[model samples]
Target: MRPWTLIVVSALVLAGCTTTTSGLMARSNDTEVKVNNRNLGRDLSLSGLNRAMVGGRLQARAELTSKASGDLYLQYRFVFFDATGKALESATDGWQQLNLAGGERRQISALALTGEAVEFEVAVRRIVDE
Candidate 1:
């Protein structure tokens, strides 16, 4: 191969190796929870955000761990979004309760109610007792 042809081939190979977040598989594994009503960071942590297409519908999973010494009660919900970041219409996006013991880790999964949801964001907060 010519030197210029070799250089172009090398460049193409390097480009293929580069990681790109332009696709649906590229997701944010955010561990921080910002809540105005309570300090969730002190007692609970979020991680392992994953997304996949199951049965032609988007599915998301998140790992939640309890950092407190005692048991903690929390509520979580999945907010779906399209490729343009617009919220998708879903009746199943409701607050679900979670109970975690100290040093316990739980993986929660939710299936998108609509096929338009290509992405998701998880919102978690402490369950306030009245």
Candidate 2:
């Protein structure tokens, strides 16, 4: 094998050793929750998403719980969409950090930045310590 081939193979192996977990997504219009990461699905639970129009803007609230026995560090972000399903915000809403105690349940809420936002999805992910 050539030296270039050996280097490429080593890089591929290193990349394969790393694991990437996508955030869990829950849609306001859907009852089913989408789990992108199985590990996080086992540790965290997200449900009871409710949305209401307040002062001509959309407000959303949801229940978040930590099933783990220890403290769980996590992050969440809300993506708002219009009636046609087009995203209103350019996904610029940054991830907000959250910490939950063992078996703790909390109500998380977010208000749509724009009144045109008619639908929404919330994504939650674990904060991996490197």
**Top-scoring candidate (lDDT):** 2
Error of 2 at 13 (Å): 13
Kindly list the per-residue Cα lDDT of model 1 for residues 5-123, writing each as its tens digit.
Answer: 99999999999897422211213445444444435666676778888998888888888888889998887777788888888865557778889999999998888777888888777
The residue pairs in collision within model 2 are none
- Candidate 2 lDDT, tens digit per residue, 1-130? 6999999999999987875437688899999999989988998999999999988989888899889999989998888899899987733488889999999999988888788998888899888788
Which sections of candidate 1 miss by over 4 Å?
Answer: 1-38
TM-score against truth, every candidate: 0.70, 0.82
Per TM-score, the best of the predicted structures is 2
Off by over 4 Å in 2: 1-21, 90-92
Error of 1 at 94 (Å): 1.4
